[model samples]
Target: MQAAGPGSNTARPRNAAACVQVRLDDLIAQRIAARSLVLAASRKVSAAQAGVKASRFRGRGVDYVESRGYQPGDDIRSMDWRVTARSGRPHTKVFQEERERSVLLVIDHAASMRFGTRVCFKSVQAARAAALIAWSAIRGGDRVGALGFGSGVTGEVRPAGGPRGVLHCLRALADWDTLARVERESGPAPLSQALERARRLARPGSLVVLLTDGFSSDAAAEAPLARLAGHGDVRLLLMTDALELAAPPRGRYAVALGGVRRWLEFDAAAADTQWTDAFRHRRELLLQQARRLGVAHIAVDTRDDLSRCLAPLGLALATRRSYV
Candidate 1:
């Protein structure tokens, strides 16, 4: 049996083996290069806040705009007690609508993402995608934060503005990516739990980006995604590998994981059509659920360029649906 397999059209160059490891230096370089790229839909953030586009809804901001007599349906929680007493009538504080939105990245650095036959690992691609989005968010004057999780480790960063926020999120991404491979304690699916955590971190008028390999695309993931999308613009960027979509020709291939090497017996008897179909079905279901719950979904093959794949869809996610 031949040890080498035919490369897919989407696969990277012949020297792709050199790019296997996830490097912080490479991630930093990608961020620096992203400075020249512009995200068009992110520019409509002010319009989204104004309700002109069905994107993010306006929420109470830090800057006070005005105070006025409370209307019948006005939220009681927003009532200004001191102003009400001073005016001898019920009053409410109105805040300026926040146009600068928050960008939240929910990245999964699971062990399954560590295996890649071509180009780079899914984790590396995810990191590259995150860097691109982080820099874009910062350039658009939005706050950036992240929830990085894998195996038994999780890191959370609160939303903040400017280069500082972007840098912090990138550091967390690098740290988690580096540690994911060493973590052997696996429990209840990490993606589902990560999504639940993401739902809690999301604030109204925020953009939440989920980066995963569709490992937990089951019932456990749907509810939390719906909840997250209810309050924020949720975009699911799924990472895939060509090997999962199609089986290699008949062969007994050697594969290694967690320092253990094993041979996968494949022959005419092992028609992988069913296995490939199941993988395709799972991906389809995730995409369908995203549509049903109003979450934007984009699929990226590990062999593809992260920046090019996400630029167009990122714009659509910014304006296509309402985050209310």
Candidate 2:
């Protein structure tokens, strides 16, 4: 077969070919290297002119205030052993509530995110969005962390403050984005599993952002998402592709999976009506459920510019800094 020219529409062999990967340097350039990019994006947050509700109950505190005699309702875990021994009375350590909010980026690198026909793959776009949010969060004096799920639950990064936390989260994002391009044959970890893990990682008043294609039919995640939203802020960045919603041109096409190449006969006229309807139904159902569950849903397409696409969400986030 003749080689695919500079502009061929055929899907290339993902396994045999060196898939275009997201480089660490490039991510750094977009984030730390280009400090102004992050600063500019952050500046827009204040312009939103929205006030974030302060957290109601103190979740966790950073600085210790003072030691006092233990009250009947005081938590035993907060006992000051030394003070109790010295004073011959039970004493409890008092800590001031931490002002910093924790932001967790639950990024999905499932196989579905690996394909894109426009600007970049969904996986890469997800990474960019995560990076932008991480920077914004850290700049706002909030802690940043991540729970990544690719072929399976890849890993989690505990929340931390300042540049260190943002760097750690971005590193994990880049790593997972590269791994997704490898084309693993194993089934992807259910989106529900990731949500469950997020439920555990997030504390009350925390901000949780879920980045995915939003094509899953798994209803199991509904409860967890609602639970998380109940105690913390939950936002969804639904990654989508223009082609996914509709059939491609009616013609024969070469589809590549792993190292094998196969021919797929694409005829919109002969396409199964039920399958098309199912796709539309699933998409609508996912959005409807997200709204019903009281989570902010933003549709992010592969063609979208990361910074521009995320600007409006920044405003929503501005009002979400503090949660009950």
Candidate 3:
């Protein structure tokens, strides 16, 4: 799947009445369901050698607190030259370990995401997924932020703690959804651009979650995705629709393309094979990329229950291990 062209019909799925768009109140209500969700590192401890020191679960401290007299075990790299010269004593910068982890959500609202043949549009499902993740993160005492990109427009909410952070992200998601629904003239920005922006906004130890249909992404996304994954955990939530995975029952269907009515024939076996193969190729490309970067990838179909679709994510977040 690629970005929808100009004047393309943004048709709703057969069951479109269920959830065509996301509401702020619905997103906020996810907090209640998120109470049972866990987004923190697991408490289970692995065996370690008696003489070996255990590494920290999170990354090294990056926020400076104050300078103090250097201790024998202090890292030399943290030495404060100015303080050492003024006091005639070696001093080192002290840093506080961040107790709260940062989670950045990169959501895609491209035109391709606006079509679905199930419970909701891909964009709507992505918003719900983002909301659930945000609520779960906040529940775990972590900071939540979001970056929404579509139709050449980008919106960002800086990482913040508590309900304020979740609310800000929810609003951005809602606004992006509305824009994607109304704007059909311009194509969506490439996925690489959004990933690049996320790289700049993310902190070293942040967990970056990308919610996209994987249609806007291509070979161009490789660099920024790898760079983002280099310093933090990157998770891909690939949104898909049932029709995209398989051809409809053998028949001739009338469809609208670029605001023009057209007839499509899917009776031929070769056409079905081609349709399936196209989606398969896209999925395999993304999966291979995630494998190379050692990141986690989860596929969520439009018809899938959000709770069940996100079960793997909970496990992934709870452990340091990567999954595909």
Pairs that clash in candidate 1: none
Worst 10 residues of 1 by lDDT: 1-10
Error of 3 at 191 (Å): 1.5
Question: Which candidate has the top score in TM-score?
Answer: 3
Rank by TM-score (best first): 3, 1, 2
Candidate 3: which stretches are off by over 4 Å? 1-18, 41-97, 321-324
Tens digits of lDDT, candidate 3, 186-293: 665777889999999998768999998877777778899999888778999999887888888899988888789999899899999998888878667767788888
Which scores better on TM-score, 2 or 3? Answer: 3
Scored by lDDT, model 2 comes in at: 0.69
Provide the lDDT at 280 for model 3: 79
| Higher-scoring candidate on lDDT, 2 or 3 | 3
What digit string (tens of lDDT, one per residue) describes model 1 on residues 264-298?
76676446876687678756767877888877678
Which run of 10 residues does model 2 get worst, by summed lDDT? 41-50
Q: What is the TM-score of each candidate against the true structure?
A: 0.74, 0.72, 0.76
State candidate 2's TM-score. Answer: 0.72
> What are the root-mean-square deviations of the candidates from the true structure over C-alphas?
7.6, 8.5, 8.6
